[model samples]
Each structure stands twice: as structure tokens, then as C-alpha cells.
Target: MKVSVWDTYVSREDGKQMHFDILVPSDLKDENTIFNFGKSYLKSKPFATKGLTSKECRFCHVEQASESIEEAIRSKGYYIIEMENCN
Candidate 1:
């Protein structure tokens, strides 16, 4: 599936930066919904994260999704690819 990749850099409560990608269908353009998806991902993490806003997350690119990512988006409406300081 074609996906929109949102490059996100959020400040962790521990004073470190967290980088990740918020992936959703390219057609999904609602910023609020995307931010909510990002919030949901943060909730799944053990550490607390600063609020996710447009300043912290922006459209990075669009690309073809992998099989796993496609399946994830099919079920959850969005998927996250954690890049740094996730643990």
C-alpha cells in the first residue's frame, strides 16, 4: 500500500529526543487524526513524551509500505516505525 511517512521528533520526559515515523495511508490528511495516532503510539511506550504537534511532526515523504506495515495500517488505520530512543 502507498503510505505517507511523517517524520516525528518528540522530546522525551528524560530530556532525550525520540525520532519515529508515523505511517498512514497517503490519502489520510487530517492532522488531528494523525496526531491522535501519534499519541496512541506514545501511550504504548513506557516513557512519557512531550505533546505531538505540527511542530514535532511533519510530512516527510510517501512510499510503498512493506507487507507488515500494510497489514498494520489495514487494521489500525496507522502504523509507527520507531527510529531512536524508543526504549
Candidate 2:
């Protein structure tokens, strides 16, 4: 199994910043499980839940992010079967 981490920054109304760290497991099959876990983790954090919603497993533009995530995984000794955004 491989794991990928994503860091997303969203702006808040008070000029502060909110960050969401999303962890995606390569072998994860159930989207609902991932979403639920992410939601629970973010909700338990100290920050107010006003900015970006909880970290999401499905990204609209995941190509570039997936490439970066895959590289990071490879560095950690995971065997990558396929990768995108090589450039």
C-alpha cells in the first residue's frame, strides 16, 4: 500500500489562512470511507470550520497533484504501478 499527502491552503474571511492535509492511500477502494475519515479528522481540529471543507479524496484537477504525490511515494520505497503528469 502507498500513501500520498496533499496540503491545501484556503483563505479565511479574517485574512487568516486555513490548511487541509489530505492523505490518500493508493489501495483505498471505498471513497466514502476516505471522505468520512477526512471529515472526522478535520472536524476534530482546533480551527473553525469556515474555510475549505474537509480534505477530499477526489480532486477535480488531480493530474498534477497525483504526479507529485506519486513521486513522494516512490521516494518512500513504494512500487508505483502507473503515474501521470510526468512532465
Candidate 3:
């Protein structure tokens, strides 16, 4: 049950800076977890997402995400640790 919190940043539709921490198990490497994270994150941050489509969510766009970020996420395990909005 080990966990790690990775700090990251994202820009809101209005250009506001949002900081966040993604918590994941130490051995995560599954795409389903990423999709689930996107689903859950959107529900928790509707204002930030505003009018974006599912494909527009950061978690859903892992392929285009920074390599380091994706690597870190995959290296961990397939379950979502926690998505903390640090706005």
C-alpha cells in the first residue's frame, strides 16, 4: 500500500493557474486507471474544466502529456491514488 504524490500544474480554461498533486500506488501502469482518473477528476473540478470534452481532459490525454509525467504515472500501478486539487 505504498503511495507517492506527484506535483504538477495545469491551466484552467480561463487561464488561471492550477496546481495539483496526483497520488498513485508505487507500481501503477494501466491505462484504465488513467481513464478513471479523468472521469473522477472532471467531476471534482467542473469549474476548471468548464466546457471541455472528455478527450480534452489532461488524464485522458496521457499520450500527449510530458514523457516524465506519463512515465512516473505508469511506473507506479493501475489504480488511482488520489487527485488533489491544489488551487
The model with the greatest lDDT is: 1
lDDT, each prediction: 0.94, 0.45, 0.46
Q: Write the per-residue lDDT of candidate 1 for residues 13-74, one digit (tens) a residue.
A: 99999999999999999999999999999999888888899999999999999999999999
Show where candidate 3 strays beyond 4 Å.
50-87
Relative to the true structure, candidate 1 has a C-alpha RMSD (angstroms) of 0.7
Clashes of 3: 5
Tens digit of lDDT per residue, candidate 3, span 1-87?
444444445556776655544555545545456445545555676566433333333432122334455565566433333333423
Off by over 4 Å in 2: 6-17, 51-87
Clash pairs (backbone) in predicted model 3: 27-76, 27-77, 28-76, 28-77, 29-77
Per-residue lDDT of 1-87 in model 2, one digit per residue for the tens? 345444445444455655454555645446565555555554555555443434423432222236666665456422222122111
**Candidate 2 clashing pairs?**
none
